[model samples]
Target: MHSTNAPASRILVTGVGANPGFGLTRSLTRLGHTVIAADARPHAPGFLLPTVIPQVIPLAADPQYSDVLEKVCRDLAVDAVVAGIEHDLVPLVDMRPRLKATGVRVWLPDAESVHACIDKAAFHAVLTANGIPCPRTWLPEQIDEIPDGVELVVKPARGHGAQGVHFVNRREHARVLCELVPAALVQERLYGHEFTADCLVDRDGVASVILRRRDLVKAGLAAVSTTFDDPVVRDLVVRTLNAVRARGVCCVQGFVSDDGAVAITELNMRIAGGFPLTEAAGADLVGQMVNGLFGLPVDHGRLTYETGKVLTNYVETLAVGDAEAPQRNGHSRPVASPAVQVRPDARRNASPFLYGAETAAVGRVLRSGQYGHTDVTEEFEQRVARFLGVPDAVAVASGTAALHTALLAAGIGPGDEVIVPSLTFCATIQAILATGATPRFVDIDPATLCVTDTLIMDAVTDSTAAVVPVLFGGRAVDLSAVRDELQERGIAVVEDAAHAFGSRTPDGRRVGATGALTCFSFGPIKNLTCGQGGMVIPRSPQEADRVRRMRLLGVVQSQDERANTTTYRVDGFGLRYQLSGINAAIGLAQLDHFATTANERRRLWRAYRDALTGLDGITLVDVGEDATPHLCQVLVPDRDKVFAALRGQGIGVGVHYPPNHLQPAFATWHRGTLPATEQVGEQILSLPFHQHLTDNDIEHVVSVLAAALDASGGTS
Candidate 1:
């Protein structure tokens, strides 16, 4: 009678493919509420649930994810949203304000509390600082401090579903695994009977806890559980929840050792996968949760549960092979055909692929009616800025636009000169020409294929305005050393990082994070593509603003005006180089999977390196450990003949560049003699490298190249 009674409400639940979301959706339907189950995958099993609406949403890491969720909530008139997976928790919490504007209720802990539970290391620190009983945990850097012969658990600090969790008994093994696991945390292994507390904390901070013993576990899911009653355990669960500042519905897990002491393991800010047992044991958990969700007072009498009731889970086949059938009422249905699968060998050119996220993003822009530079473009810039650890980023039409904008913002013009590597694409020279500045071509280091400090210093003059160091094939130039030698002289270092989107430095810092100015390309062949786009990361706020203006024809405040639906005046000189909203949408989608794509590229390059080792008449480019290779380039004798031979065998290959100094347009401005660059230009050949290439494809390429070498009678 707390005025919380309302008609059945519509709710959206994320990660419905997982056990918690799936189960939660089923329970909500039983309670007479409409459920919208969402998942990143199109064919998630949760979509098959009766009386539930299924939605395909982009992954949380996607740049446009929050926007899409907001649109969905508004379109469907959803009344509430609940996260069923840890991955979606952070995004939903961050979108609280937007959801509130739409009057969609969400029950979740604060951002800090949610993060503390999701990050295991933070959870351990919180409990330990609060004088709670928890296992000893150490970060990867502290692995050496662990004693020998002690059982340990090495796992990713932010992992869920027990993935990447490894058990070890030696410090050495832990140390070795620390190198493999991302953001690893090592903890002392605990042995005892494990229990889960299904908890609900009302808005007033009062708690209701249901204890369940996990009698059997499989793949991190509780397969069998029994209801239990223990005051000592319930009190400890409440205390631990207080320590972490947890509210709303959550689950706490721990162990009861032989010494009769409880040590906390981890806390999840979501319902337990085995939560059905609490209801089966006679507790009205879900009903009270819905009441609390609508700001109603909980009924404590209904929260009581009987002890010794058991629930066992088993796998069942809910679906089988695809089939088509006509309705009994004589209605016909259309059945779509399956997609055709293509083999890697069938393609004779470099692979340029697209993911579903890209198509969805582009479609979103097309429907929004604002196709010019808009909010989506700004969001894409912000995402790239965060990824590069830079203060600001500007998106433009192409790699040339990025460099042109950065150079103009840096105050370079007619009388100034920009130093560039001779062994680079023609775009570098074109950008310098666009700035009305002279291009000073310099020789590159034979091994790195990048301009060195010695070459840069030797090329410097009183008229030198900047140094443009090209990150050729994703190999990072020694920017730190280059800065030390050039910054004191007041010359800017503008990095041409077109081929190095996800490359990192030796110290683990991302490439664009530092340097005076950096530019990235998203052309068809780059690591992360937006179909066609570019980005500029500036060191200072003033430069960022200037670059922003320059990209839109010098129209002052055009970007702001577009977002606010206002008009702005034209200012100083600029160009129509701003990236379109549709392209930015694609770029945003690509950024979501940038890390995975980069790692896969690196893996493919390594496989090629290992397979071709000691091959006669072929020398691989020595890409440094810190680099993420964009293309696998090698120096070969009779390069043109080898290139033709590979193409004939359906193994695509090409030359990266013919030295810029030798190009007709750049020949007039060439100043220095680039012996190393000229020599490399004649011998370098780029191999087909992309994430879609399999090991078998690589082996075939190697075999074709070896045979071509033998036929040419070159250094057998």
Candidate 2:
């Protein structure tokens, strides 16, 4: 039932499949005022929202979702339409006047600013008009007029990210260039230092800024960034923002030549991708932007940040899988380890992960120096790479470090902003912050837990950098569509596939194989246990090479005998976060156990469903086609009581998470509500069913759950 009393203070956020955008959408809708989510994909994460809230309009409306988006504003009498995806932004802006005519509002950069923000050539020209120097460029339409002495760089005028930028050494590729560019540009790539700036210009035209220097870690998003107050670049940013006439959370990017001239590269007319870092650095950007856009007064000059501080992605390490247990190396009925490292019994029940292997493994590694090159480590990384069908893999210290390393290789840094989901783990947000880039926490789809396109568009600004999609145990986010959108935009995407090691999409491809940089975890709790290790799988060999060197400092690691050694030419101060040899060995052993492990999990999941399906109010996860059961999840009305009752019965149950936005450190950006996340979060619970459990164990778990539900009055 739609609320007739919905307030105008409510904002509707769309883009349900994309992570951050969905986060924003969920947060707003939870406030119980008004929010309409729309997505092109039917099963996008946002659509999975509980039926209690009005359903998200399929981006493909009844007439096709875009049309529905228009009607939603009129029907709901919504106050503002939050544009979430970049592709959706322009059209939403085009619909603005008609929406307003019906008394609804849509937040977007004006059409002119949209073109300037999205098109490389148009953006460069605008920058030049504002006296902000850009890379020397000649559009293909003006190709014959190219002057004789411009040492050549080339790019497609309409391109986004680094898609069309190329260094042309030969004239032969010129014809190849035309296919990409309606007109390509032959420019002089300058000798300049790259940096990004997160600045906000209020409706009154004031610029508040922070400049960060890109550092030594991952390339696409910064492994780390240091802030510097550069008056020159900051002023240039102001000039560029003024030229674009953008009024939201805009981030501008440019380069400083050796001669110290500042040139504008582009503008993010919406919320830039890297805004999360700003929030983590103690800046409440979402609240500020929402406040600023709605005719609220913003104090732009009141912000300040510490210089040279660093943040890193939070990490969950991997453990190598052991080969099938029965026939593996003849270590049949195992003897006890020399010293059993059990936790003091009481704390053991409170832990989520299994530390049985780790306790034994860590003690051994400290004694044996063979950590990196252990047969166990190599075997596990190789198998995981093969399982994901990726070309190569490098085991790192943890999943967070894997993301940080992938960003370092991609070259994301200071002044850059990476798009992330506020509904996801704090680790992703912190990873971008570590690189001195801003993290734009986009909204999320409540059902799929994936991000939607609408949120991505609303948050994009001139300094927008990259996009990251997290597949949380692979329920419903489709990376193929997300990849398509990002590719066309010229931005890079990195997959944070920590919880999705063995999952697949509706298409048969593995979750980590979607032509993007994917990072996986083998933490103690993952489907495949690595006491502590991670792997980065890139889409291309060049990208693979880039991440390879960046993973272990800047020095390259060739595929040679010496490549496995620790002693080498370290290029920079890299983190000592490589996976240990001991952890690797355990992972390899688990690899032998893979088929059975996965099979057991699926069978257990089905059993849980069949047994619990007859009950009322407890909703078992719907895996649709194309998903490997990772955790057995259920939604119940009285979660605390159910959880407590099960615990009392000695049947351990778990929770997937608490939304990152509500964490105390992030509370300032909470924006008042996150109904779907908070409500669903409470009802969600994971049942125990590792390979060690038997069929009888499954029955016992179901019985306990049933009794708990009945005791809690859910059956009534």
Candidate 3:
């Protein structure tokens, strides 16, 4: 191992997908230092290197770049950072102060110097001002002024490597290319031998330069290179470095003309791609860089290298496996998460109404390079808690996860019975089953299609561990009279408020604020769409902690906490039910415009109510005024025939649910017949109800419903 004056550090190296970064990572690890290999692409070869920690980060241009980098540095306890590519140089320089404040060391030139080196036009100006010979350059607007018969290179002013670099012998071709390339510039093509100087400038302003000839070049990289001694190239490179006020590890490339004149071409503010030759030739470049990075004096003498040593590189696959092998692995729910499910178009079908800000929010979260439960998810949780006036809200992957997590946190397990109505979605039953609790199906009050306190108490047995009151169609269920008795009997109240997000309880408090273990679905068709997510409002801080731990696979420590240490503890059973930042971002956006959504949904529900008034043989299921209606349901005589006729007439009608207790999956839990729930199940028909529906749409739907009822003989 290459010994150093100081102990090895845990260094983060960006741009590890490229050769320079890939080589730098291996070299640092060889020197007994830990390397965090970071790249924008997940399949970057450096990620597969043994003993190197792989990290996929947002692209440097992403707005969240600095924040994500800072979090990575902090979480991994990184001591220093080194840029192996030019793309990372500007961002790293901009983040230098924040990184330093967080105790992560970064050695970079000032912003002005970095900008000057990266911008081709600026590089040319600096060189010319310093009396150094270089190519004549012109911006795109100056294309017409180019002299005839001169070969030209058209490239981006702020380009790197050979990307967007095109060569042409004619001015017309150059002009056409300048229009095609963004931030394009033209430079006079030079003819001669190309050379790159691997350079390190000490804090004392002294410099050591290693010169290497591009013996065999390919794709802007020196595929084969031999180190050489040349005073003309060395002096010019040093002059160019000093001209731009460059500091730390950098490189200068130029050409040695046939007449022995040296033209400084470009300067890069990072390690050279072929610097492996410098190390092979006995230079302590990286070691001295480490010294300069830690505020220690650089030993310039050790930066010296022997001449005529050669290094060559060839293409070879580092790994071959499934491209999706690097997926974010976690325990996903047995049911598909909402984010992946297809959603209906708002204009054409009953569907979620996007407030136009959701895409931008999701994009921002995606660029943050974190998908799992994070600060974004936490922000969503806090916002929801504030909206509901609750102590805390736990966000999970889906609505089923919310119910499952809440039930588990409430101590509902095997041998316990949960009293729930049979008139709700199958997801409710599945969540109860997932917790290993038996569901005691109960009858609902036909008027509200929600279970009554009397029905709940009548079904409650000595074995009843909890009572899950499903808020059907955004209508709240009031069980206050029996709540004391249920508590006395040690039965917890876990509310399945999937459709009652903005509804109020009997006491006029928000449904989730009534001190019950309430769950809300931010699914695609809910009052608020999180693109498919759920929230659990815990009644106590202890319950919140239980759900939090259970969502991330029983890990006591959070994702951030686990990053700082080498190991973590699993406190109990759990699943991969954590809400991803992507979904949380969507939820945050929806919450911001929830008031407008509530108003529109209420207006549409009223429109349907007015149109259905005095309609024969149809009874409107009441969702109280305090509720933000999620569905417009009516019990019609001959419901099956009317439902089919409405579908045939394109009215977008559906059955709320079949009695869950009678379904094949829940047959074992069937406790005889729930007469009211059974009647509602057969008669209940849900019309198209969403924020997108207008009075005109409702009128059209009501007219179609009237026609369908007439066609079905108008009676049961």
Candidate 4:
């Protein structure tokens, strides 16, 4: 390890996927400091110390993704970080606090200079306002914002690497897009050769021309790119840099207008995708950035913009046939391998929406250096709060943590009988049991696949201190009546909204809203997943503080309370259940798109219901008028055969749950029999669902199910 007091002389290389980032990884690895890389794709290449977190997230937008990168620095003991793409820079800049706070350094391009980096409208507005050469641009917010005569391109105000950009000559396509992303930018298409200029600026504000490339991209940027350098390009790049106040590496995109004036497109703050070329040309940017950000020094010959480079990138298809795929969709549903089992929330199977950039930004500060241990966990609080529209959110290490925190916050302890549905995930029962409370498994309602209000009443006893309503398939049991009843009995309610994230109760309220302590799961298999983690949103400040401290290994309160102090001890006992900054970073990105993800799920739910509504021998769980289903579930006859047949075709399906009573640990918790939970356990089949599936995949799944059911002597 490097000396504790020495200035951090190392740099971080993240997102080490393929030979694309190999050059970067190799460069950092050779520097001798601990070089860590993080990527979800196992096939990513290099001397990768691959984990699940990268140095920069949001790739471009700062709506806040720096949190994850910062956390990685703190947790991994990294000294400096280098964002290898335009999408990496801004969020890193935005997270200056978290990074600086941890003493880890990051080089951020001047914001005013990089403002044109992600926001096309902001860039256009800035350019138009400054009389800089710009394409005809206007905000789509105006009346019929599409360009009337010329073909126009529409892009988001703030986006990463151009996700939803489209060009259309017709007005209709522009209008349709305007409806999709409100306050988008419409720019008249500039038909000309596109190019990029790579730059490096030292602390002294001296800008170096690295390499300018002739950007050859197909359909925006899916294909490969080949770069060429020339005087015209050189002049444009120098002028563009001069126009902006950036003092770090920046890649500016521009087009040679038909009139010969170079019309600037956008400025990218981080090293562009073509940075490897800069390295290939002799400028070691990653190493340079590490030195520049931390006040370190480096010697280099005169920088020259290099030319004539060839690079290519290709994606390989990996079949995750049955090896426990992570989550996709508004809810945490299993992966469907063969017949696309898309979750209700995944609209186009476009890689499932990630957590909000906000979470990623904060997580960076929390996780970014060696002084602090790496803390990556699930969205234990944010997910629950979001699902229930609660104002408070706190993430924990696991779903079990969520329940434990909730139980403790609600004052359920030794000798307390917490009425819980025997049909839910074991984590729920385990959480309560960890609080020294006994779980009372109440019968579930077959229609909703959740514990019923009447069952709670039947199971209630003087020892009953709280009631937990467990949900399944993103569908929930009506808990309003039970909640009111429990309140009357002076019992607390901790709703396990683990599987009910996108679900709403009848009367338009959500599952966790009315609960005193609501818990949610974002485990690799639950809604809005992050490998493993959970959340608990309490109703009171006292409960929130307890949950927060308990998550952080039982601290008294915020760092403010413990600042300048050396040690801390638990006042009431706790465990290490704090969510990792890295994990939270992912959760942060995923949650931002939750609403869009949720709506897609509802669409899938409708399609499933409509397709199988009249089928006999199979009962689709009714979400009720008040509930919006997260996962599409059904009770089918010959369930085993249907599941087997689906799997035989390489489709992965799931059983919503096995009754808790069957678990050896629950043997004495509720020794009483629960026939309803038992019966549903055998018949309930969770079809594959996630956002990564196409509509055709869903149709195929329905068709396969229909055929399998008919073969098993069931009618549709």
Q: In TM-score terms, which candidate is top? A: 1
The alpha-carbon deviation from the true structure for residue 426 of candidate 4, after best TM-score superposition, in angstroms, is 1.6
| 198-236: candidate 1 lDDT, tens digit per residue | 998888778899999988989888889999988989998
- Count clashing residue pairs in model 1: 0
lDDT accuracy of residue 100 in candidate 2: 78
- The 10-residue segment of model 1 with minimum total lDDT is 328-337
lDDT of 3 by residue, 1-716 (tens): 23456456678998988988998887776655667788887667776564465667888898877887887787556889999888788889888889989999988889999989989998899888989999999998898899999999999999888999999999999989988999999999998889999999987778899999998889999989999998878888889989999889998999998999889899998888898899889898888888888889888788788999998987756555332332244211011123322122112336776654577799999899998888999999999999988878999988899999999999999999999999889999999999899999999889999988998999988899999999999999988888899899999999999999998876789999998999988888898889899999998999999999999899999888999999999989999999999999999877876776787678778888998987787899999999999998999888999988877766788888999988999999987888898888888999888754544567778888888888887734
Candidate-wise lDDT, in order: 0.82, 0.63, 0.85, 0.64
Rank by TM-score (best first): 1, 4, 3, 2
Reference-based lDDT, residue 444, model 1: 89
| lDDT accuracy of residue 185 in candidate 1 | 93
Residue by residue across 387-474, what tens digits does model 4's lDDT show? 5687877777877888888888888899999888888778788878888888888888888777777788998999999988876666
After superposing candidate 3, which stretches have Cα over 4 Å from the reference? Answer: 1-349
lDDT of 2 by residue, 1-716 (tens): 11112222546666655544554554443333334455554334554332112234544223355566766665443567766655566667777778778776655667898888777778778877877767766666565666555556666665444555676654445446756655576666565666767776776777677676555334234456666667888887878888887766666767777888877666765554344556556555555556565667665533456666555533222222332322122211111122322111111222222312334455676578665645556666678889778777878878888888888767788988787776566787777777777776666666666666666666666777787777755553664545566677767788788777777777778877767788887777677777677788877777666666666556654435456786657565466566777777667655644554565456656767777868777877665446566666788888989988888877778777667777787664455555666776778777875543434456777887888888889875
lDDT value for model 1: 0.82
Candidate 1: RMSD to truth:
21.2
